[model samples]
Target: MERLLVVLCPELLEEQEDGRAARTFAGVVEVVESFSPAAGAVRPGVCAVPTRGPSRYFGGDVRLAGLVRTALSRTDTALGRVEGHIGVADGLFVAVLAARAAGDEPVVVPAGASARFLAPWPVEALERPELADLLRRLGIRTLGAFAALPTRHVLGRLGTQGSVCHELARGMRSELPGYRLVPRPHPATAATGDGSAGAQVRQAGFWGEAAEAEARAERALGHLEQLLPPDGVAVGRLQGGRGPAERARLVPWGGRRLDPAGPGPEPWPGQLPAPAPASVLARVPASVVDGRGAELEVGPSGLPSAPPEQLSVRGGPWQPVTAWAGPWPVDERWWSRRKRRRRARMQLVTSCGMAYLVVREDAGWWVEGAYD
Candidate 1:
């Protein structure tokens, strides 16, 4: 219905700091209809914004996209350097692919031709494994190949999803968009993203300084611990913009010491390593995504039962179910010997709804799908 843009830009700072060969390219997309990360930028670095409303107000999709580009350019100079590559297709997914296929100029996928454009791409591009595997087994490789097959057979083979893909071959990308749940990044002594806090980094160097790291770590823990209730749950999911491996470093204390003098984490040896920037931790709070229509209900059986109205989770009266749904009984994957479970069903929900699952499991209830 509209032109979705995937703007590719080169960072001058990275080049100036390093070399021309070390150019860092950024893709800032203007997503008119979805909340996808690739569709929009939603972080400290860059983001994507939807254009549906803009299109309605500005008379057309092209004008909406143009307005977005202008807004992006004006908001922040660094954010402004975006290079426009437009993809006009029936849906976001197809538009993005069309844009990807475009070279330097803005690529546009004309409406009504999305399904045809997508036919040549690999089956893997669809991002749905269940559908991809079934198609691959039937000797279908490209979207076109699958499209050429009997629609009824494809649907029967892959279930209801195959019909969507069949239509996609004709250039109708109908899959939902993807949005990145930006995890909260833990604050580091070296990290200056947040200001106005006590024990500033340079004021207290993390490693080289005499006890600053310990102090700062204490302050952070105190901040976190304060968030916990006194009598109930002790260890709850910690949510931040960062992941587990990306979790912030805390100056370790001796069991229950409130204020610690850093001799360098006692339990943590001097040579201990830090986690990767992208590492997501089990302790870290996972993101709960929005699912339209269906509602999640935690059955009264103390465990998840057949389709319920909504699901409920209480992490020991502390963390509660933020959202949930779906015991959407998946009877497939049974053919695979590895998947030969007495019973296997996936509860499609996020950490919020899962907290209750964990508590119930800890209380001797049958555990179900995790936030993972």
Candidate 2:
């Protein structure tokens, strides 16, 4: 019912790791939905977490803030003097602005007094360079000065961003509807036969779906044996059959692309460097049928196609798509959009990290999924 405590590390922008550290940092606060990079190199990390649960569980917001401080400060040495600061306010945007202002040191805006606390700060507190410049040109240097200016003039001059800057400069935050995080299951959708024969066969989910797909792709790409590095190293990954495709979003909304080279605490491949996190597509079943009619059924034989047009997934920094199945065509009613189903479809996954399926609608072939 109160404000969420936001913890920040200005220097965190320099830490070149995956999103895990940034996510873990938000976990220090509450449920971490996702982390967004403001600008330069995904650095300048900012995490948003709910405060009610932590404040209640920890007895109070002040204590919760202290706990966050302890968690962030308790890190490995040699990371340099990276200070983690905590700021508490009525909302996330305000807390972020306040946290940025109190850099390298902790500060908590008193409950219900966020507006008062932000009144004296500079217009740059909102961090919009262009808007800040415009405001300065208009002689509005401080939050108090901006607040004194008319809202109509603000909006007319700067558009929506101006309205946002004004609201945030006054400790007001845009209300974001709360949403839930969907779970991403590992990819290995394998079909294994029973010890006796086909009728007794069963398919078990593999532990590492990404690796399996990658291996399958690498094997399929054996045709390019000479192109492969002597070490069988891979270049990148693909999401559909041998040909190019498009993307589709199902029940799960937005996905966090893991940057192997981004700001994470742990190194990828243990000591070896890793690539930055990027967006991955989710592989969702377009249609389902009885076992007898399943395309890539629970049996071992997944959808396999000819060598030329087959898309393979290879692992390394990128992957390739080897084979494809389905167009086991399906169509479903889009409840939200209230649209009737019309496209034919199938699924594709490659070794590296791309997961997709093709829609054979009149529009030709289009991709519909990628796993994160």
Each model's lDDT: 0.41, 0.45
TM-score of each: 0.35, 0.38
lDDT for position 317 in model 1: 31
Clashes of each: 36, 47
TM-score, cand. 1 vs. native: 0.35
What's the true lDDT of residue 206 in model 1?
20
- Report the lDDT tens digits of candidate 1 across residue range 1-372: 444443433232112323231122222333322333325422222223344555566766566555555644443333344444444455446655655575544455555667667778998787777878877887888888877876546533553345455655654434332311122333441265644222212321222232334435545654554465322222222223212222233432221122223343233211112322232233322222123323322343423533332333322332333444332222324588776422222233333533222212211223332433
Once fitted onto the true fold, the runs of candidate 2 whose alpha carbons sit more than 4 angstroms away are: 17-44, 75-82, 103-105, 174-372
Best by lDDT: 2
The candidate that wins on TM-score is 2
Q: Against the hidden true structure, what lDDT does model 1 obtain?
A: 0.41
